[model samples]
Structure formats: C-alpha cells, structure tokens
Target chain A: MRELAKMVIVLTVLSSLSGGLLAMLREKTQDRIEQQVLEFVKGPAIRKILAGAANDPIADRFTLADGEAKRSFFVGKYDGKPDVVAFETFAGGYGGDVGLIVAVAVDTDQIVGVGVTTHNETPGVGAAVETDVGFIRQFTGLDIASGPKVTKDGGSINAISGATITSRAVCAAVGKAGDLYKRLKPEILKQLKTFSG
Target chain B: MAKTVTQEFVKGLWAEIPPFRLVLGLCPTLAVTKTVEDGIGMGVATGFVLVCSNLLISMLRNVIPSKVRIACYIIVVATFVTVVELLMQAFTYPLYLSLGIFIPLIVVNCIVLGRAEAFASKNKILPSIADGLGIGIGYTLSLAALGAVREVFGSGTFLGNPVFGPSFQPFTFMVQAPGAFVCLGLMLCLMNLAGKK
Candidate 1:
C-alpha cells in the first residue's frame, strides 16, 4: 500500500509539471503560429495570382466560411471592383488529402488561378503539383471552355509524367472548382456588387 | 550507470532501429521522406521531441499509474510535439508548410509512445535520454537515405539541386508511393544481407 501510494504521488506531480510546461509553451507560441499560418495560406500563391491588381489579394481581404462539408470564401474588392472569390475543396489523393485553392475572376467567370495549398502526393511524381510551375501555370486563364483534360486527352495542359493518378486528381479538382464557380458566380457577383455599392 | 546509458544509446542504432529494424513510426517514415530536406527536417524534429519526451517520462515513471499510463504519455508527447511544431513554424516556415499534418501527427508516432511505455517507464532519466537520441538518429538516417534515393532517380536532383545536369533523363517513377515501398524493401534486404556477411 505504501509503495502504491508513493507511485501515485510521483505520477501526479510529473503529470502536473509537464502539463504546466506545455501550457506555458503554447501560450508563448500561439500568436506567432497563428500569424505564420495566415501568412503561409495567403502568401506567395495569392500574390502570384493577384499580381499587378490594384487591390490586395483575396486571401488578405476575404473571410473563410465553413459549410456543412465544403469551405466557402469571399474576397472584398480590387480597385473598387469585386474581382475575385474563392472556394476550397478537399480531395482525396494517392497518399492523403489535397487542399485545392481555386480563385475565380468574378467579372469574367473564368479561373484566375489555382493553387495546391496542401498535398501528400508522391514526392517527385504526384507532388509535381508544387514543383512543376508550368503545369500549375496552365490553370491561370483556363475556364469551363478548356474542359480540364490532360495532353493525352488532347487538352492543352500536360500531366506530370508517370503520375497519372495524382495529375488526374488535380484535374478533377480544378474541374470541380470550375463547376462550382459557374454555379455560384451569379450569387457571388450579386453579393459583391451590393457590398461595393 | 555509465554502462547502462551507453547500452541504451547504442541499442537504438542497430539492435532496435525505430523504423528499419523495430518497424516503429512507419507512418512519418514513409510519408515525409520524399525530399532530402524534408526528411532531414522531420528527422531532427522527431529526434528533439523523442529525446525530451523520453527524459520527462523517465523522470516520472515511478509516479504514473499503470491504468492511465497511455493517456498520460500521449498528453506529454503531444505537448512536446506542439512546441516543436510552433518552433518550426516560426523558424522554418517553408519546411513547416511542406510537412503539414505530419508535424501534428508526430504526437501519435509509435516510436515515441513505444519508448515511453516500454523503456522510459522503467528506466532512469539519463538512460532514457540516450535511448531517445540513438533511436531518433537511426530514424533520421533512414529517412535521409530514402530521400536521397527518391530525389536522385525521380528528379535527378540531390537536395533540390540538379546533380546529373539537364542532360540526364530522370526516372520519374522513383518518387512515387511505389518507389517509397520499393526503396524501403530493397534497403531492408540490403541490411539483412550485410548482417549475413
């Protein structure tokens, strides 16, 4: 009984100490982490797409809304014109989830750009999403008219060689994003116009 | 005490390698080893977490109750993981973003948990720390080797720089998921062969 009591006391003290240390660490870094996440999500990719725009990037101005399943995003304005709105989709990839960021030009109803925010696709092959600038750049001006197919299917964009599954996954995600944009464009534009006025 | 500490540290490298020999922490081992840099980053992060957690757990081994040991270990491990994650975010944002969910997932990595339960729970603090370092280094070395194989064949690059020059035709398939398995399997086979010799 004495041994057991001693054990219990030691365990309790250790747990408490460790917990307190963790709490202190979390408090110290929580704000910095939040800032880092914000910068990462909105940094280079958003800037790349919104290059030369009179207004700030949509990621900077917009608020993200969580729906039942999907995420909806609204960007404020560009040069007094509501130019972009985005929607994020989570797609299953070869290794894990892929987060696709699709930004649309509200006025044109065309894709402004598409960025892969997160992916666990194979490193050199499926992960070409990040490494292959040309492949991603193809999405810049594409829209419903492009029909989102690989070069093998006579489309303009070339798929990453030897990573058909991952390439197809990205293609499908972009296609879906385009479809969603088409469906949501009218309402999004209406909201933008009201807000701008 | 000195002999025991030496044993604890040395054992992790060969007798009980975290991934190759012991087959612990396979998830992160396979998931983040696409690039040499990522592999090294993950290895270091995991090592830091492992060593700290092992020391703390060892110090508290006498006190934690048997019935709730697992829960207490998890909480302790998670706290360290969170600290590591935040540090990476602040100091190595690009690498942190590249690692993504795998960082948080480290909290559940079997190697850390396994040590906490099997060894640290019954060991002295110094020996546990040595064990953690040895195991962590073994795991890191394995990841670096895997990353080197994938990066060289798949992209003709070593650590993000083109090694074979532009003229070399890279084997794109080597960086895919299948390649991870193939590389690991072949490595295991080689290790077994060396042992036989």
Candidate 2:
C-alpha cells in the first residue's frame, strides 16, 4: 500500500509538470502559428489572381464561408464591381487531397485564376501542377463556357504528362468550383451590391 | 560510466535503427522522405526533441511512478515536440510547411516512447542523452538515404536542384508511395549485404 501511494504521488507530480510546461509553450507560440498559416495559404497566389482588377481589396479582410461541402470566398470590391467571388474545391488524387482555390471574375463569370493549394502527387508527374506554370496559367481568363477538360479529351487545356490522374483531378475540381461559382453568383452579387451601397 | 554512455549512444546506429531495423516511426519516414532536404529537416527536428525529452525523462525517472510512467513520458515527449514545432515554424517556415502534420505526429511516434520506456526510464541521465543522440543520428541517416534514392530517380533532382543532366529522363514513380517501399526494401537489402561483410 505504501509503495502504491508513493507511485501515485510521483506520477501525479510528473504529469502536472509536463502539462504545465506544454501549456506555457503553446500559449507563447499559438498566435505566431496562426499568423504563419494564414500567410502561407493566402500569400502570393491570391495577390496574383487579383492583380488584373482595377481596385485591389485587402485579401486579409475577405470573409470565408463553409457551405454544405464547399468553401465560399467573398472579395469585397474592385473599382465599382465585386472583385471576384470564389469557391475552393477539393478531390482525392493518386497521392492524396488535391485542393484548388478558384476565383471567377464577377463581371464576366470567367475564371480569374486557379491556385493549387494542397497535393501529395508524384513529383515531376502529378506534382507538376505546382511547378508547371503552363497548366495553372491556362486557367486564367478561361470562362465556364470553355469547358474544363484536358486537351486530349478535346478541350483547350493540356493535361500534365505522365500525371493524367492528378491533371484530371485538378480539372475536375476546377469544373466543380465553376459550377459552385455559378450557383453562388446571384447571392454574392446581392451581397456585393449591399456592401457597395 | 563513460563506457556505458558511449555504448548507449552507439547502439542506436546499428542495433536499434529506428526505421529500417526497429520499424518504428514509419509514417514520417515514408511520408516526408520525398526529398533529402525534408528528410534531413525531419530527422533533425525529431533528434532535437528526442534528446531533450530523454534527458528530462531520465532526470525525472526516479520521481515518476511506474504505473503512470508511460503517460508521463508521453506528456514530456509531446511538450518537446510542440517546442520543436514552434521553433521550426518561426525559423524554418518552408521546411515546417513541408513537414506539416508529421511534426505534431512525432508526439506519438513509437521510437520516442519506445526509448523513453526502454532506456530512459532505467538509465542515468548521461547515458539516456547518449542513447538519444545515437538513435537520432541513425534515424536521420536512414531518412537521408531514403530521400536521396527517391529524389534522384523520381525527380532527376537532389534537394530541389537539377542534379542529373538535361538528357536524364527521370522515373517519376520512384517518388510515390510504391517507390517508398521499393527504395526502403533495396536499402535494407544493401544494409544486409554490408552486415555480412
């Protein structure tokens, strides 16, 4: 009984010490970690997409909404019009989750740009979605009417070589994002008008 | 005392290699070893945490009760992992982003807890520190070797730079999940061959 009591006391003390240390460390770094994650996800990609607009609204000020299974993005204003309203779409690829941040020009319903956010595909093959500028660059200025299909399938955009699965996945994700954009456009436009007024 | 410490430190390199021999921490070993750089980053981060946790755990071993020792060790290991995570995020954001969830998952890595129970709990502080260093080096070398094999063939690059000449047609599949297994198996075969000598 004495040995068990001693053991319990020792364990309790050690647990408290370790927990206290971790809590202190977490308090110190939580803010910085949140800031870094935000910057990493929204840095250069968002800026590049919004560059063509006449007015540049703060990307940081944008609000994010999670719908049933989609992510809705609302950009405040660009010049006299809503800059771009977007929905990020995700799909499973050969490696893992492939996410695309897609924005459509509010005026023309054209794709502003598509950014490959998360991917774990094979390097030089599916991973080319990030390194191959041509694949991503084609998304810019493309309207929903163009049909988001690979060139081999009789569409305008070419699929990445040796990474057809990942390419197809991205293409499919962008197509879904476009569909969501069209569905959300009316409500987004109303919200934009209210904000502008 | 010095001899025992040396033995504990050196044992990890051969007798108890974390991934290849012991088959512990296979998740990060396979997941982050797409490139030599990422492997090295993970290895070093894990090494730092291991060393710190081992030292602390060994020092507190006498004070921790046997029944709850495992729980106490986990708390210590997790605290060190959080510190390493925060430090990497602040100083090495790119590497941290590349490592992603695997960094936090280190808290549950069998190798860390394995050493905490097997060696640190019964050993003196100096010897436990030595054991940590040895195991950490072994883990790092294995990851780097794996990463090197994958990056060279899979991408025709080493550490994100083109190492192979332009004429080299890279085998894209070598960097994928299947490739991880292939490379690891080949490495084990080679290690076995070396052991025979």
Q: What would the DockQ be for model 1?
A: 0.28
Model 1: pairs clashing at backbone N, Cα or C within 3 Å:
A10-B63, A11-B63, A11-B64
Instruction: Report the C-alpha lDDT of model 2 over B11-90, residue by residue, as the tens digit.
Output: 88997887978889998998999999999999998898889989999998888877878877887898889889887886
Model 2 chain A worst lDDT window (10 residues): A57-66
Q: Residue B109's C-alpha lDDT in candidate 1?
A: 93
Question: Candidate 2, residues A76-188: lDDT per residue as tens digits?
Answer: 35665665765457878889879877777778888878878778898767888876888888888888545588877777778888888898888888887777766666666
Candidate 1 stretches greater than 4 Å from native: A1-23, A49-197
Q: How far off is each candidate at the interface, as Cα RMSD in Å?
A: 3.1, 2.2
Please give me the DockQ of candidate 2 compared with the native complex: 0.37
Model 2 regions more than 4 Å off: A52-197, B1-7, B14-16, B20-23
Task: Give me the candidate number with maximum TM-score.
Answer: 2
* Model 2 docking grade: acceptable
**Looking at candidate 2, what is the lDDT of residue A105?**
74
Candidate 1 per-residue lDDT over residues A100-173, each given as its tens digit: 77778776767877778778898778987866878888878876445587877776677888877677677778
lDDT of 1 by residue, B3-33 (tens): 6778889888887876888887888878788
Compared with the true structure, the alpha-carbon lDDT of candidate 2 equals 0.80
